[model samples]
Target: MAEVEEIKNLETNKCKQNKRKPWDDGPCLDRWEIEKFDPSWNPSGMLEVGSFSRAYPKRREKHLLKCWPRVKSALEEHGVSCELNVVGRYMSVSKTKMTRDPDIIVKARDLLRLLARSVPARQALKILEDDMAYDIINIRRMVVGSKEDFLIRKIRFLGHNSSSLKALETSTNCFIRMQGNTVAAMGSFRGLKRLRIIVGTCFRHDIKCVLWMS
Candidate 1:
């Protein structure tokens, strides 16, 4: 009887040792807490922080109206709304305020900036044609100059409007314009080199020499 009692006591002890605690049965710690100890753990790449909208400076009302068609079309696709103050040039574009997704606002801003540069609605809208080309245009615009500079060159070109100058713009990517009597070539560095070669080879007599602004 004593031996049997001892055996029963031992079995009870083993069962008590095997019992699980409430805390142990549950998740001991959060996954993020465990991640701190893990060398290979990483957060997800697609985390959204907040609304991606901001206050943009109001531009010329006439300018906005000129590019209104392209602007309206681009923003309408994303369901974004824009308000304009023609007298003050105070235009505001927002998305989250109206409970709409703000993902496409960045592209809209790009188009707006392009228009603000005095780029024609036709050329500004071309940004929507190809994503790759749009990226290139952004880089080129940054490096070359502002849209204002390009507009100045364009105005000069129309005054001359010669077939040969148009061909130069087409062939060499250099938009040749008259700066007084001399021909000024404005374009990317590559276009400038090609223009120089063309001037040296074929049109030295007519153009004298091509000058580029550094």
Candidate 2:
């Protein structure tokens, strides 16, 4: 009986060891199988490695010690003269043109804010790409508005999944962020015009009217 009990205990311990071997309960690997990596046979297939270096030339009047690639691209595309320069511990910005203009300065600050926050840099820069001249307005700026006007009923992904959001962006030329139950959109005059039409037709009862006044 004693011998049988000892054998049972050994078997239980062996089973526990087998179960724990595969689990990552420890910091280091006890055993590893290193096979020769073949890109062709890889499930993901030779993925491209990412780099932190800037591909564009850093020669411009404006200097920002560091800026995201998307931010720099948007600035260059919009004819905003700027460059990046590394200061002691911060990025120093130098702008040759439109430095004194309040509107341009405001837009620049907004752009930086969006990029620095949780928003993706590419999505944030969409505000800079506009076919029509439009004033940028924040939702907080409008203190007075109808409840119907402020409230938006979001039709989740329209028909498809998240690509619908991208479709809306392409169609309306807007940068849209989905909040808890509604969507926050940023666009130019023309883009907003299209978006308003979309809301009226698609959303129907949610929006009574769309109006913008300078």
Candidate 3:
């Protein structure tokens, strides 16, 4: 009887040891449910805004109005909210609840800046891509000459029938635009680097000489 009682107790112990704990199954949680339990798991609710002042808002007002709908829709697809202040001549981008990627706001800002710089909406949208980037180089500061000299240098940069500019674009694989005193370019990092060097050379040396070296 004693032996039987001991065997029964041992069997009970084995049963208890083999039983699974509630935690052993892990938390069967949906995404939101998991976020609810872990505060760090959720993205911040704070709003982020990026604002830009366009250089020629009045001149492009009509075109901007026409393209605003498309731009807004594109931004919406990325969980960004955009607003155009026509009177203020500025555009603003803000993060919304749906925004999860932190880099999206920066990309949205670049898109607006490119549009403001007179880049076509179709081309400007390229900024939203991960591998694309844009830069606005202030050529006004690079010129060390009088207004006439500056004009002459600008003309040289454009070349006869813009052939020089076209060649630079082809060689560097970048799109370049001369807007007033600034030069805006969009391309990959390597392309942009070559563009900056070539543009700086245009201001420093004769375009013909730069072309020969290239």
* lDDT per model vs. reference: 0.45, 0.43, 0.74
Weakest 10 consecutive residues of candidate 2 by summed lDDT: 205-214
**Per-candidate total of colliding backbone pairs:** 0, 9, 0
**Model 3's TM-score against the true structure:** 0.73
What candidate 1 gets wrong by more than 4 Å, as runs, is: 1-60, 66-70, 96-103, 132-159, 162-165, 172-214
Writing each residue's lDDT as its tens digit, candidate 3 over 1-214 gives 4443443345445566657666566666332221112323446743655443344468778878899899999988877888888777778888888776667788898888888888888888888876787889998787887888888888888888998888888888898888999999999877887577667655755344234334
Task: Between candidates 1 and 2, name the one with more favorable TM-score.
Answer: 1
lDDT of candidate 2 at residue 176, scale 0 to 100:
65
Indicate which candidate wins on TM-score.
3
Ten residues in sequence with the least summed lDDT for candidate 3 = 30-39
Candidate number that wins on lDDT, 1 or 2: 1
lDDT of 1 at 92: 53
Best of the two (2, 3) by lDDT: 3
